[model samples]
Target: MKKLLLIGFMLFQYMSFAQEHAWVYLTDKENVATSIANPISILTQNAIERKATHSIPIDERDVPVNENYISQLKVQTGITVMAKSKWFNAVYVIGLETDNISVLADLDFVASIDFADKSLNSESRVALSNNKFEIEESLIDFEYGSALNQVEMIGVDHLHVSDYTGEGIVIAVLDAGFPNVNTMDAFQRLRDNDDLLGGYDFVDRNDDVFEFTGNEHGTRVLSDMAGFIQDEFVGTAPDASYYLFRTEDSAGEMPVEESYWVEAAERADSLGVHIINSSLGYRVFENENYSYTPSDMDGNTAFITKGANIANEKGILVVNSAGNSGGNEWQIVGAPADASGVFSIGAVDFEGNYAPFSSQGNASQPTQKPDVVARGAAAAVVNSSNVIINNSGTSFSSPIMAGAIASLWQALPDATNEEIKQFVRMSASQFNTPDFFLGFGIPNFELALEIGLSLAEEEFVRFKVFPNPVSNILNIQIPTSAEPTNLKIYNVLGKLVLEKNIIQSETKLDLSLMASGVYMMSFESNKGSKTFKLIKS
Candidate 1:
């Protein structure tokens, strides 16, 4: 009788203290049309210009979250607002696992509830953790020194030689604490140039990002892109401007960090950031019940992944690190990396070999992940102490690749974000044959530049190909020309599969007889020869 009484008492106590983490989705915004009418009020002038250049519409997603709804939730008992996202029109809230919080669902403006702990609600959980960024461990006119291998591996050196070093480009680095970036000698150049545009600590809700006492993961990640130390070192995009944002809480592994990331990304978009490099990934968490399975790696799932796609749609190039779980149980790329719009990056050694620790992509997913590879094994980086060190993980590779992309974008300023991604993918070494490990393999920036320049020409711009990665029929919209054009399709092994003569502006090729694989379609004429990557589904 005493044992039963003790058990009943313990159950009551457990229920009293249990806290829940969830996202409280709002029904509608109070003023979407008003905000869209005056975009400059919410977004920076530079951001407005970027959207104009890309022809992206300023829709309701660009509107800020309604403050009144947040105010109402803030006044409620047993509820604490954590973060809010303008893209999803939702607010992250933490509260006691009791009737008070659950009553939020009954509110008229509340759309629904998504609990981080699946047991609290009917929905399954997504991934959240910082274990991936833990690593064992640049520049221009520039001795790359220890950073030479990584920069040259992706042909960033060639872009630097052409004087395309990310000048006028803005990048936002989102990760954990950036302890000494404000004082690091390696970043002194960035500070002196005044390229260090301010940032915010979303985790602590402060303006300071370099004052934390946790891990220096952000410092290391930033060094790969913005660090400069004269002849001793030069980051890939030393000339590029930066905004340092701390979104990860290294002290604890919680699902709220994902909401923190979305908030940061929304801020980045408003600031007109041209590129966003996230050297962090999510998978397992402290509470196994909040973990996501391998199948959940689909791009359409995960709150952060959805936010990433929205970031891409807003014309910001989102670059993320493929997690370091290749040899572990969670071997697939995690969360935002699985996001189709995200350019997920993987790790390679100095010799251009795949790093065993680099995360692989899901075979079932149609979109190839880890879009490309770079030197991550023994990659050179600057730490919080302002010292160069060797580290291994996709964490390092992502920044290396992102910095190169910034430089590439600088060279091709007029190119759209989608065009830039296609240029990089087409220039990859394994564009004709990608796998789960390296995706399209290491890219060649020099080759990508060449392709971009060629395609940018007025005559070449008229050449359009529809439905890339087709199943049965491929359509080509040939540019009008007096000279007769010839077409050739080749397999991965460089063996010719089909040849045809073009007689009109539009032509269709029946590929149903061909086996499923990647192909290179070449259009040759008196003007020149242009090749495009083709995939068979």
Candidate 2:
């Protein structure tokens, strides 16, 4: 009986050590001498340039975690460091026994330790399979034959024709795995031009992303943005530089992937990636206890969602896929998709109809989700074998939209990321009346360009009209280079009250004869036309 009791105790101790995946939160970066005021010491030159261009200030969160703390923890026996997050000031470690946790917590620099997984060996939660629709491949032509339809559907072809094919933009794609991206002919131009900057596989904690034997979901998703095959196909942003990050583990669904995603995002930000395209969403997990119900779809509830928001705050545009759970019993968009400031994309057919499998937004959230829809249903993509094929999912749509956004930014380099998002939303077909399924509807890149150009003109011209409530004369001041070619004043009833042709920098309008109310003064020039509200007394 005594021998049996000792054996049972030993087995219990072993079991306790077996389930030891926890996060060690460091108290501070004390050992590191780098100060947050000097971001150049931590961030790359490109990252500094990006922040300067966007007027984003460097904060303490941008600094790397204390290397001394990490090294000390690594030296401890029976502990294996998994991943590190500078944003959270924490490191995920496994194999930490109860005694080690107590001792580590007692360290001066150790703030806290939380078990990532409280229970193990729970019932396996079923993974949600992607609802992909297979379609026959179309005949490839010499001029974006199959790919043209997708780009033209969202009016991105206009930007491409205008020489804004996302040149000088850097985008980071985070997904399951990119199997044959290194050898795929469709990505040859990206490789040849050195646009494929770098990549890392967070799951294995290595940089060998191309050598993975996981799903080809990332390959197909990337083809929507970077793939090019002469005239046969042209991606949305073929000239944009890319960073590929493998953050998803195809074999399992767990919260640890979220931590991996945060780590990859921090890396992307450090590398100065302008945009991040994430085709993965989380709601269900391998452990049922870790699975999130629809109520947790609130943007702030999930760990990944919080990280995505922080990435946006760092001046990086995040585009995510609205999960394809429309027909499932738990039908709703997943966590990161509901994240605020994220450009969530939904799936739609070529006919501009919502795809049945496209997840809907949570009704409880005030903000309409799925900022826009794109040609995700039967979307064209290049597989790992370098063959063009058709598949269906929002995974294809998010990148499609992200590439277009990159092109838009390329065209309007002076525009802020927030302004670009606003323009895209305003240019959508249903901006005034958005719904949960396809919020604001499909975006028209052509319209967005017009708006951007108009805004630019306003900034450049700096034209102003003053003397609102003027009893006699109203003065108009125009920039010397942009003298008004014509001017017109209209009443609220759309009746033209006055018209004149001006070739001078200053024009005086006699408003004494006009009745007191709201009127509009129109100014037309070679650059563009603008209208301003005039208040008369």
lDDT at position 321, candidate 2: 92
Compared with the true structure, what per-residue lDDT tens digits does model 2 show for residues 155-200?
9999998999999999999998898899989999999999999899
lDDT, candidate 1, residue 244?
88
Give Cα-based local distance difference scores for all models: 0.85, 0.80
Backbone clashes in candidate 1 total: 5
300, model 1: CA deviation in Å? 1.6
Which tens-of-lDDT digit does each residue in 462-507 have in candidate 1? Answer: 5777677798888888777456789878664334678899978888
TM-score of 1: 0.86
Off by over 4 Å in 1: 1-17, 123-130, 138-144, 460-528, 531-537
Per-candidate TM-score against the hidden true structure: 0.86, 0.79
Displacement of the residue 414 alpha carbon in candidate 1, Å: 0.9
